[model samples]
Target chain A: MLSTKEIKQSIRSISSIKQITRAMEMVAASRLKKVESRVLASRAYTERMQQVLSHLASSIPSERSHPLFTQKESVPVIKIVLITADKGLCGAYNNNIIQTTAKFIKENTGNTIKLIHIGKKGNLYFSKGGYTIEKYYPENVEKFGYNQVKTLASQLIDGYEAGEFGQLHIFFTKFKTTMQYSPTSIRLLPIEKDAIKTKVIAKGEYIFEPSAEQIIEHLFPKYIETQIYQCILESLTSEYAARRVAMIAATENAGEMIDELTRSYNKARQETITKELLEVISGAEALIKG
Target chain B: MAKTFKIEVITPEKVVYDDTVQSITAEGTEGSFGVLADHASMIAELQTGILTISDVNNKTVRFALDGGFVEILANNVIVLTDTCTKEGEVDVEKAMAEKASAEKALLKVGSGVEKEKAKAALKRANTLLKLANK
Candidate 1:
């Protein structure tokens, strides 16, 4: 059993920890609100873009393919873009994404793998594991804007055009709800026709400005850029959500610890007082008898 | 009141414009074109230029659009672009600086891809300058 002094010390430390965790929870909640709104606003643009792409895909003949949509079977190297949070207080958020990416790499042993890390945590883990890291955009996850997405998209497209890799895939956490997020992998390159194709075929025949091919050529890059932007936004939102939940749990645990410690402290103090009282009564009885 | 159709100018960050307008005139890749109410459903690739919109009251609003696509379906016109700035929102000093830097980059870049990118930047800067001056 701990003495009252030791128990009191633990209680003080735990209450301070609770204070910090409570503050963190509030911060995460506010940040989550901002990111959630951003994610919702960007959904409209991505949905509209998907609709236009599907319309264009249906109009163009299957035989005619754009450079972005061309599959290169000869190249054996696979490029994986892994997105994770820079900071790691969030429970299992970064670990889950890194594990998913590692599993992907392990499953595809036949082909050589190259990684492009979007966050510091992923880059650090992969680099320590002796994997080949082609690019590392550390700290960009926190402050990614349209220009950053554009530059990243252009780099990926240029690398693909140069035959640096056969296929390009991105791994990110999809934000389903504040309480739920899952690691999702999307094949970005070679423009999966079936994935973008909509069930509701566009109503009427449409006119293209220069040609269907030319419009698709322009639209494909924009499509890729938009997809990357949307994924980053979703991942950011999920990170905030995860952090909020983790902090809330931490705060609750701290509260429980503080309560238990306070009880033990009181019990130890009461035991000491009872023992002193018994000694005092015995001393009085001994004196009286003497 | 004139017959108006819905137009929404959207970027990745947010929806820039969403309202019913009488007509919209924008610069397509090929040439400048105007779309009135009940126009045919068409998709046009836009270049960096001024986008003019006329309201029901005949008041015109101009925006500098930096390269995007415009889709017309039913009575809805969707302008999906990288960036859109209204006439008064264009910053003159920033546009001038961008124009100068883009010109410098265009002169320095030798590869085809770099040249194309620099050209696009120059065009965007020019459009913004024009809008700001107007």
Candidate 2:
């Protein structure tokens, strides 16, 4: 049984913790709203880009191949771009992505695996584990813009062209809903042949300005850039959603603890008062008898 | 009333414009071109320049576009760009400041990708200023 003073102290501490978590929950909710809009807007752009690229891919003769579509039989190394959150208070968000990457690396034991980390948490975990970190962008995840994504896309394209790695995979959390996000990995380089193949063939012959080859050549890099940008936006949205949920849970737990502590504190105070009253009454009776 | 076609100007951030327009004139990498309703299906690479759009009411709306691509099919025109700012949306002083900074950067950077980027930035700034002043 805790003394009333101890219980009271605990209730005060817990109530303060509840206030902090409540503040965190509200902050996460507002950030989530802002990021959600960005994610939805970018989604429209990505969908249009995919539609155009697929149309081009299907229309172009098979013999006309782009360097980006070249798939190697086997290569010595594989690169993984792992995206995680910068901060850790977000439930299992970072852990899930890290685990997914680890599983991928484990499964690809025959090839040398290197990592490119986008967020600090991934970088910190992988760097300490003796993995070869190809690159790490230390920029804050919340501030990510098109420029940063462009630089990253160009680097990845250059490395792929230079044959630095046979295959490039990106691991990110796909935002399905506010309550659900799952870590997903997709092969980014040497884009799979079937991925861009469209079911609907061209209804008629189309004119290509500056040549079809030039247009396809220009569109492929933009395709990669848009894909990467969409992934980053989705991951950021998921991060905020996860943080909000985690903070809400923390706040609720704190509330429960305060409630329990207050109950115990009241019980302890009542017990002490009853004991003191009994002592006083018994002493008075003894005096009366004497 | 002029026959109109649907035109959508989209950037990565959002859809800037989506409405039925009488016609549109855009700068293609090959050269400037105009499209009316029932234009042939075509795909053209775009350059940094002013995009002139005439809506159903024959009202002209201009946008300063950073480099991207334009696709036309049937009666629909899709203009995709990295950034698109309407004439009314362009900030003249900011465009001037950007132009000055881009010129400085163009002078400082040697021959390579950096120079190309600075040149593009300068071109975009110039286009924005051109549209705004017009």
Candidate 3:
């Protein structure tokens, strides 16, 4: 028979684990709140930027003048920038992106595709799967800032302008709601036609300051950078939300385990007491008979 | 009639200024331009300079902008900037320090991307300092 001491030890270990998971859940919840506020605040800037870009794209004549607007004739090479979290234990947060990238590579068998990894998880997964990693962002994902995104944007712009890659795509988790995030792929290069459509206001006749061409030369690059920055912000918010949900689930599971262990521990103690009482009664009965 | 139009100055951080205004003067990439109520629709690239607005109360509010763009509609003008600070909100000593450091970096770096970045930083710092002093 198992001793009561062993049962007590199991109960103690389970309770300690429950405490740790509860603490982690609280931490994730607080971080999620901060990121959610930031995402909400940045939405205004992104919406205004989109409006301005669409206005320029629709109003201006000769849209093919800017290099960003023009597309190459045939697709030669493709670049995919995959974003994942550095840390694990966030449920399927990193797994979803990794699997999506794997599927993408599997489908595009003949294309010359190069991978650009933003977080360590994606890099570790793809590198093992025998994919060519063009670059891996060295900085920790938690410490991301606008300045880092700007530098990366500049590099991408330079490469796109130089015709290094015929097509560029970015894979990230789009934050739909606090409880839901979906993995999405968006084309980043050559500026998609529908993305510049303005739904807010009617098209109006406008004057360009230097010229439409000159203004576009400046606006297009900024527009690209803003899009990248927004995606990063959204991904960060989603990561926290995912982590919070995962931790909550883990904490609940730990609670259930602790409950089960406590019940078993109590049952073992009761059985031990009953056996000792019977033995004492028998011993007294034998002495009286003698 | 108050004879006012709406203007919203937004950055990545937040909406710095949003109000009905009488008039506004902004430094465009080509030159300085002023907008009044019912001005013709236009899109202009902004430089690192001051954006002066005359509010509905005829009180002039000035903002220092760090190189963005201005969009003018019939009744609304929206300014999209990387960094926008109110004249009163700026700290001159801090801006002066940033300017000095940027200038030093520019001089130290012979020629590269860092030099260009430092030059741009110096320009933005100077704009902030000027707006604060004014």
Best by lDDT: 1
RMSD of each: 4.0, 3.1, 3.1
Question: What digit string (tens of lDDT, one per residue) describes model 1 on residues A205-229?
Answer: 6688978788987897788888988
Per-residue CA lDDT of candidate 2, range A1-290, in tens?
88888888888888898999899999999999998998988887887777676666666676876666667647778988888999998999999999999998989888899898899999999988778998888988877778888888888888888888899888999998999999998787877555543433455656888888899778888988889888888999999999999999999999998888888888899999999999999999999999
lDDT of 3 by residue, A116-162 (tens): 88888999998885788999986777686778877888888888888
Number of the top TM-score candidate = 3
lDDT of 1 by residue, B45-122 (tens): 999999999988888999999889998877788999878999899888988998898899988987999899889889
Query: What's model 3's TM-score?
Result: 0.87
lDDT of all predictions: 0.87, 0.87, 0.84
The parts of candidate 3 lying over 4 Å away from their true place are A103-110, A195-205, B2-4, B98-126
Candidate 2, residue A115: how far the Cα is off, in Å:
1.8
| lDDT for position A138 in model 3 | 66
TM-score of 1: 0.82
Better of 2 and 3 by lDDT: 2
In candidate 2, how many Å is residue A14 off? 1.3
Model 2, B8-115: lDDT tens digits are: 899988999999999999999988999999888788899889899999888899999998898887787888898999888889999999999999998899779989
Relative to the unseen true structure, what is the C-alpha lDDT of residue A257 in candidate 3, on a scale of 0 to 100? 81
- DockQ class, candidate 1: acceptable
